[model samples]
Each structure stands twice: as C-alpha cells, then as structure tokens.
Target: MRRPVAVAGAAAALLVALTGCSLGTADAVPGAVRVPTGPAVTPLPIPEVEPSGSAAAVTDPFRRAADGTALPVLERTPGAVFADVTQADLCGPRYSAGVRGERASDAEEAAAAYGVEDSSPYTTDHLVPISLGGSNEVSNLWPQPKEGAFAAAAKDTLEAHLRGLVCQGAVPLETARQALVQDWRAAYDTYTARPLATPSPTAAPTGGDGGVVSGGVCATDGEVVRSPEKQVRLTCRPDAEGVLRWQRRA
Candidate 1:
C-alpha cells in the first residue's frame, strides 16, 4: 500500500484533474453582471412640436379681424373707399348688374376664398360696409358668419354705429372704414362695449311685385323682398328725432 510508484501515478492524475477545472472559471455566473461589447448606446432625445391650430398657427396674415373674419378683396379706389355716404347716396337705388341667381353665384365665389364649403352658414358680407360708403366691388366683400359675436347682425350694429358716428362728425369717414377693415369685431366690442346680439333671421316669403316704394306688396305684407334688381330693399323706421332711418325688413 505504501508503494512509491503507485503514489507518484496517483499524484499526477490529481494534478491533471485540477488543471481541467480551470475552464469552469470562464463560464457565466448566475448573478454576475457582464460588460457590453462594442460602443456604448445613448438614448435619443425627444423633440417638441406646436399644435396645428395654435394661436399663431394661422398662416394667412391678412385674416386680421378679432375672430379671423376680416378677409377683404381690396377694390377701393381713393374716391370710392373714403367717400361720404350722405342721405342722397343711401337713397340712390342700388345699381344691380343681374339678379338673385347671379348673387348666389357671387356668394359661392366669395366663400371659396375662405376655404369654406356650404355657403349656407354665411352671407356675402362687406368689409368696408356699404352703409358707410363701401362699394359693391368684390374686393370689399367677405363671407360673414350668420350668427354669434362676429355674425352679420352684430356687424350690422357696428356699421350702424359707425355710420352714425360719421354722420355726426364724431369720427372721420376714412377712420371708420379703416377701423372696420382692420378689425370690425374689435371695433364692435370697443364701440358698443357689449357682445353683438344676433337676432333670429326673420324668414319671410319671397317674390312680390308692386310699387317698391308706395304700398309695395312687401311693404304691405311687412316682408323682406328679394328684388330682381339686387338691391337691399329697405323700409324706413323713424327714430326719436323723427328722422327716418332705412333698414332691411328682415
């Protein structure tokens, strides 16, 4: 049992077994962390973007009204744009080129400028209002919203106020036109100090033929007339001063 040769062989085998175990250290450990190979990675940064309809999102610089309703076609001549609209001017019968059919076409064309489909919600409105010496030229027109603070009814009130101011010499004619064309809704709130009261559009029957002025069918029926001449057929209502002011019946 104590043979030297046998002991030497046993010791050699044990050394070989120990050398074979050196590979076990290269294996992955159960909970050990490993360093990544190649280049280190970094997270990409996020970018901020503005909303499509943000306050400054509007690209059309010319839509300048408080509610973005002031789009003009720009047809004012020096004499025409700034002219004074006296009683004589308002009394002059409207110079119409065609009929209501033509006006509907015109309204369609006007609405197209604002990218608005279905012109039913809008009326072809004047930028420099005709009441304050604005012309019928296309440049003076825009599609006015039918109801709300920026509605035609509200704009009409503003027009009446400006007209009165012009007539009273409280405001210059050019000043009123410029103010309105610049921002009518602003002028409305500033001048009126209140929101525009949009009245329910009076729906009246169309087509009546009689003397337009004296005992006209529209006048008797108290209905608004869509005259073939394309005029704003108006009726006069007396004010507290006993002076008559013309207005649309509906």
Candidate 2:
C-alpha cells in the first residue's frame, strides 16, 4: 500500500514532468503513474517470464505464470497488426465496425472464457490498447473487468505512463508496446522499480496479483494488486469447461 501510493505519486510526477498533462488526467480514462527516465537510460528489455513450465516453448507475449497458466493470450491475431504508430492513434476511432461487431457479439463468449457469468461488467478491452499501436483484432482483445485490483483503471495508469514515454521518445514506441504486450504487470514492476508482490498460497489471488493462485489459474494473470494480503482478482467468468473457476476480482 505504501509503495504503490508512492508509486502513484512518482508516476504522476513523471507524467507531469514529461507530458505536461495534469498529475492525474487521462483523456481516455483517468489515472496517472510516473515512468522512469534519464539522459541515457535505455529502453528496458524483455524480462524472462516462465509461462507454465510446460513442454511447449512460449514467446515473450505468452508466458506461464506462477499458477501455471499461459498468458497474454489473445482471442486471435488481428489480420492486420499495427507495427507503426504515432501519438495521434490514441484519439482516433477505437475499432472498426467489424471489430466492434465481433466484440459485441462475442462479449458473452469472452466473459465465459474467463468463467464470468455475465459479460456486462467486463469490458471487451484491447490487450494492447490502441493508444500504443495495438490493433482491434479479436486476438488483441479480452474481457477486462472494471473492478478489482488490476481493474480497467489500473491498466489505464500504466498506459498513460507508457504513452508519455512513447510521446517523449524516451522509450522506443515498439518497445513500449511490446513490453506491455509481453507482460503488463512485469512492465509495471520494472518501470516502477518495485519487486513482485509475494504470493500467498493461502490468501486469495488479486486481479492485480500479476500471478495466478491456488487451484491454479487458467492463464497468467497480469492485474496489479495494491497489497499482497489482498488476493489477486479475476472476474466471475467460467473456464473453458463452463465451470465458474474464479471469483470477484478484488
């Protein structure tokens, strides 16, 4: 709690110093955190992520979490992935009608994939947001819940800082996007200069835990939690078998 509050302040200060945006403002959604920068700090490289310790090899975008779930899993890859971007991409129309239609029609399906009963509270959000060169492909989207530790707002804070870094040319645009896509929570941890929150096998997992929990999770979770005692949260979504596997993400 103490660290993140300070993290929040530092992130806020970083954004203020770099983007000149108010301390806590996000035009898309509001929450600000500081990003690390310096005259010669190189863009952070991809950190090793152990996805599942499975037989299959995994890429940076896909890793096994502590709970042994494959992660950064996409719905499917977009036909056209965005490799180039500018600051202007953030404010444009989010998804094409076709993409929107897919999101709308599959909203419930997306929710079900996570064992959530209803898709209403979970937003059909982009895995890598459009602001940072993410595409509107189904693979790029997921049903992100609005509540819990790594709620939509929390991701927004990371996005705001990353966007600031991109706009300021402090980090390579592609690196920022790739780092987020690889493991957003890891990226958060790296940039914020914090250690991973210790996982509690007995305590429930937070949506923001950035790791999976007991009974093992379906996928590596990236939601960043404020405290270790607070369980990592996952929405009320059902697993592939249609059994509700998770609880209210807190």
Candidate 3:
C-alpha cells in the first residue's frame, strides 16, 4: 500500500510538468486552443492629436480701417516711401504712368497676409500714392475696397490732388506724404474743400507783403509760401519779436 501511494505521487508530479510544457507551446501547434490563466485586459485609449498646420491655429494680425473705408490695417500699412525718390521724379510726366504692371501675385500675397478669403472686391493699393513717391514694397501695399465710400477711386482723386499741390509748391512733398500716412480721409477733406485753382501773377496776398513772398513778415502762423525767385518753400513761424515771418523750414 505504501509503494502504491509513492508511485502515484510521482506520476501526479510528472503530469503537472507535462501540462505546463503544453501550455507554453500551445500557439506553436497547428490546431490548438489558448486557455486564459488570468483576467481579461482592457487597453487604454489613444489620445487625439491636433494638426499643426490647421488654419484655426493661425492668428490674424489685421484690422479694418479706422474710418470703416474697407482699407488696410493702419498699423500694418503705415505706408512707406522711397528714400531716393525726389519731388522732380514724382512730378515728372512719365513718372507714375506705366510704372506699375500686373500685380496679380502681389494681390494674392496681400490678400493672404490680410486673411481675405474672396479678394475679388479688393484691389492692392499703396497707402501713399506712387505718384507721390510711395514705394512698391509690401509694407506700402494694402487691400482697398474697389467700391464703397472713400474707396480706391476716392483715394485716386486725392492722390492726383496732392501731386498737383506738391508740384505747384503750395504744399511740401513731405507734408503731403505724411498727410496720407496719418489719415488719408482727413487729408482728402482738407485739401478738396476748395476747387483747385492755378496761381496767378496778380493774385491777392495771403497775409504776406504782397505777392508770393518768402523770408518776410507774414500774417498767419503755420502758413506756407514759395519764393518767387527759386520757388523754394518757406513756412510762417514766430521770431524773437513774436511776429510771424516766412522762414526756411527747419
């Protein structure tokens, strides 16, 4: 009876070892069933990732014109001028004529920069007029509405008027340039209030000595006049005596 018990125990141990080997090699068999020895596993979910190049990630740095004229953002389109450009070049007959070519690419680029979807109603315009020494650079380019109050057509008229003023020595070139950059709408209002008139030899004096005079007593402070000799412009400012006199612009 003792011997039978010991042999039986040895046989039981051998059977347990064979079962462990079979479990390890189960997947290697042609036809085999895998038995789970532990609880089922639940896989963790994968995190969703946002696309790096999505349009929603981009921030638009442009805004509408201050006076709601559908113009470019003032901060971005502060206006730029060519350093080498002179009054003579700007006032020449062939200066602005035929100077610009097809700007389709520039228009597309400006539209993209300003976050414009449909650019059909917009035209890429210079903040300052090319006829007035404005540059062709991107900094001076902006999408101006083709139609609206104070639109591209209105600006064109202002440009022509300002060019005339600069050529006539009535307004300084720098003053016209600054006026356009500061507020084109206001400049238009101020300059266009009166119809443009040609200066006459017998024109009445404007608080000056008599005719077009420079470097002499003047009536109004902050008044500008051109010399009859060389056509050099001068401004009326206060002197040591607190009297307004035509002086060379500093």
Give the TM-scores of the predictions, in the order they appear.
0.46, 0.43, 0.52
Poorly placed runs, candidate 2 (over 4 Å): 1-49, 53-71, 74-80, 84-103, 106-109, 112-115, 192-250
At residue 71, candidate 3 shows an lDDT of 43
Q: For model 2, what is the alpha-carbon lDDT of residue 196?
A: 18
Worst lDDT window (10 residues) for model 3?
A: 39-48
Error of 1 at 157 (Å): 0.6
How does candidate 2 score on lDDT? 0.49
Cα lDDT tens digits for candidate 1, 36-102: 6522212111222222354753754234454555434232211123233454443234411221122
Clashes of each: 2, 26, 0
Evaluated with TM-score, which candidate comes out highest? 3
Q: Give the per-residue Cα lDDT of candidate 3 at 214.
A: 53
Measured by lDDT, the strongest candidate is 3
TM-score, predicted candidate 1 vs. hidden true structure:
0.46
Compose the digit string of candidate 2's lDDT tens values, residues 213-247.
33333322333222334544544222222222243
RMSD of each: 25.9, 24.1, 24.4
